[model samples]
Target chain A: MALVDDNLTAAGVAMEGEVSDYLALLKPRVMSLVVFTAAAGLLVAPGPIHPFVAAIAILCIAVGAGASGALNMWYDADIDAIMSRTRNRPIPSGRLDRQTALMFGLVLSVFSVALLGLAANWFAAGLLAFTIFFYAVIYTMWLKRATPQNIVIGGAAGAFPPMVGWAAVTGNISLDSVVLFLIIFLWTPPHFWALALYKQSDYAAAGIPMMPNVAGERSTRNQILVYAILLSLASLLPLATGLTGWVYAVPAIGLGLVFSGLAFKLWRAPAEQMKRNARELFTFSLLYLFALFLALVADVGIARFLEMIS
Target chain B: MTAPTEPEMLSKEDSDKLAKSRRGRSIALALVLGALAIVFYALTIVKMGPGVFNRPL
Candidate 1:
């Protein structure tokens, strides 16, 4: 009877691992943010990129993001199976073999970068290639399991799409493009640290050295507030630098305030407040960045079109 | 979805099926990638110069 029971449990575990592996492929949340940010950058860049190129650029960015996700999954499969939150991932669940994921990631990484370059310019393609390397090699393989500051430096990989988009159109980078990159770079720590605070146990169980896992919740909360304030300041840079007008400025200031407000609330709340507040901050932080980027796109689109005619 | 009940990787016939599935996926992947590249090249590079789409309409 014990033998049968053991066999059943083993089979059940295998099935769960399989499903999580596929979910790891989709990397749905990451894809959502990448697509939107890349599209906004393309729309607002100084020149007209064919709509088709714009679509492809976004697709390539998404594929690159997925590639990074797959690589992360492949590397972290062992730990993922240990954590409750990640146990359902494909590799962890044993639905998809790690070898299959590694092949998929490599193919997508090569395909997306090579194709982006051919479609746009070597520069954009190069950026995509570097992004894949940054996330998969530097961030995933090196940083993520090593240090608490992993997301801070690693976040730049996520921040590259807008620059890639600008390069797609302009064939060069600009200060405005850099500003977009900065916005995301600064925003990432607070956004992720919130999740870290809420999911420290998952990180602890997985043996991943996420900041909150290494630092106690008190220290992590302090870090979130500090980063949040820094992010708010960075968010306002578009106006101070004159990269954007009040069309972007007004909302940037307003949204920055609310984002900071939430961060502080998260900081001050009791340990129990950590989960709910962190989730709220995570969800709202996404909206904040999206709105900011959309505002910039709208301003640039309207203003540039007016210039072309007048 | 339930994976196959077989514990072994594949018998000769099953290997054939696996090969076909993989080939199908690869071909489909190639076609999709090709189509996507074509679309991007047309928009990003071909129609990408100054005033390329600046018509007043």
Candidate 2:
């Protein structure tokens, strides 16, 4: 019995160091968001792409996003090991070695960018390469430890995917894609500040200069409110530009209001309920972005259906 | 000269486990390399298009 128990424990420990460990290095949740937004951009663009080509482009974008995630994990492993929220990440948990993760990330980055250039166009591929560099080098290595404005600037990396998708289809960016980018860029600060409000100690412990840590909670809350109001207006730009119609506008306005309302509530919450309020705002922010994007896609789909019937 | 020193022996279960792990790693590496080869080959086909065989001498 003792021998079997010992073997079982050994097996369990060994199982932790598997292919899944390497996959976890990719940060799959973030990759999913990138994929969804990229696909929406592709679908809404004013060009026809073969389904196979579309699939290949989206795959390359997802792989490129994954590559950036892996590189970030490789670079941030030390701080990840220190933070309670991130201590169980692949590198921090000792499931994957740092050198192996670094090499894996580098190889994936090259492969993803090259494949995207072949599958789509050089413009989209260039954007992917730049996004990876911006996230792994600019954000993770420099701004993360240096300034409270890290999220505001680092948000550019995440906001580039839809534009890349647009370029993949159109071979150029237009005002429509820029509006998509701006919506995400404006939305990022408040979304991240809400989480930072609740995870203040984790950021402090990790030596990261997240807004709530460098600035007081009052300042952070005020900034979140300000960004929320800006984001609410920015979300309506697609409607104003006629890229999307009322189908998208109604939800954009409604969800934007809800998001701003949550931010205001968080700003006004008592000290005792601050954590709960921040968490609520963080959760709602995710829904707000997703619903906004989905509304755009739906508006396009509905217009196409009507045209076909007419 | 003395006989060559015998190699350290592993227990039967330990040796079996080691063999399995090595096999798994080998297969994984081979799959990755094979996939890379296929992707590069596809890119070549896309780049050359249908004109590769029809080019003039």
Candidate 3:
């Protein structure tokens, strides 16, 4: 019995985190969005790539994105602990230690970049490496704390995945990929600002300098409306560039109108209704981006089907 | 140098939970490694083609 007690005590000293806790460090929801947009970029790019290579490229990209998330969680664990929304994260909740998270992220980042270079082209690998660095070092450590424009610039990190995906296939950047990057880049401000509007207290408490915390809510609302209009216009560029046809154009126009309308509503919302309006815009913004990307992919698929039949 | 502190004792339930967690991590690690091996193997076949088998010994 004494030996059993001693062994249990030894086990207790070393807190082994569950696999799910480690996965939580990866921010799976964000990873899903990264994967979807990256896959869209890969599929929509005009090229013949080995399906196997395509799968490997996407896997590497997902792992790299998840690696960045882990690094972000490790660095932001302090502010994360202060915010109710992030208080339950692995590090903040003490399910995993920060050092472990850092090491996990570093290892995965190296592996993902190296393997992508081997499986795909070096250009795509370089983009992935830059993306990880941008998110982990630039956005998380620097921009996030220092400036109100954090999300505006940090949004570039998230915007790179699809471009990376396109590069994986074409081995070069093109106007179409740039247009895809622009759509996400412009969409990010309004999307994140709306969330900040409702969660102003969280950012204030965490000293995050989010737009709504740094700028007044009214200023943030106006900026969100402007960005929403810009994003809508940018979303139609695929059609203008002849990268996509009417299949993409029709949905793009409709989605852009709805997105801008929500932003307009939020801008004019009464103080009492501000949070609800912001939340509605935030929720719809996600659907809007997802639908827009889905439409792009669907347009490509339909075009391919028509070409094959003809 | 600081003296080593005694380890804290855990209840049987906590010990069991830790053991389960450790096992789960091991399984996940194994699956990831397996998937990686498959990826490399497929990549080799795709890149090298029948030439993979024809390499000089």
- The segments of candidate 3 whose C-alpha lies over 4 angstroms from its true place after superposition are A1-14, B1-5
Residues A80-178, candidate 2, lDDT per residue (tens digit)? Answer: 999998899988888777787888899989988988888889999999899999999999999989999999999989999999999999999899999
Candidate 2 chain A has its poorest 10 consecutive residues by lDDT at A7-16
Residue A282 lDDT (model 3): 94
**Candidate 1 lDDT tens digits, A27-77:** 888888898898887777776666666777778888888888898888888
How is the predicted docking of candidate 3 categorized under the CAPRI scheme? medium
Whole-model lDDT per candidate: 0.80, 0.87, 0.93
What's the lDDT of the predicted structure labeled candidate 3?
0.93
**Top DockQ model:** 3
For candidate 2, give the lDDT: 0.87
> Candidates sorted by TM-score, descending order?
3, 2, 1
The TM-score of candidate 1 is: 0.82
Model 3 chain A: ten consecutive residues of lowest lDDT? A7-16
What are the runs in model 2 whose C-alpha is more than 4 Å off? Answer: A1-16, B1-57
Cα lDDT tens digits, model 3, A27-145, are 99999999999999999999998999999999999999999999999899999999999999988988788899999999999999999999999999999999999999999999999
Overlapping backbone residue pairs in candidate 2 total 0
Docking class of 1: incorrect
Better of 2 and 3 by lDDT: 3
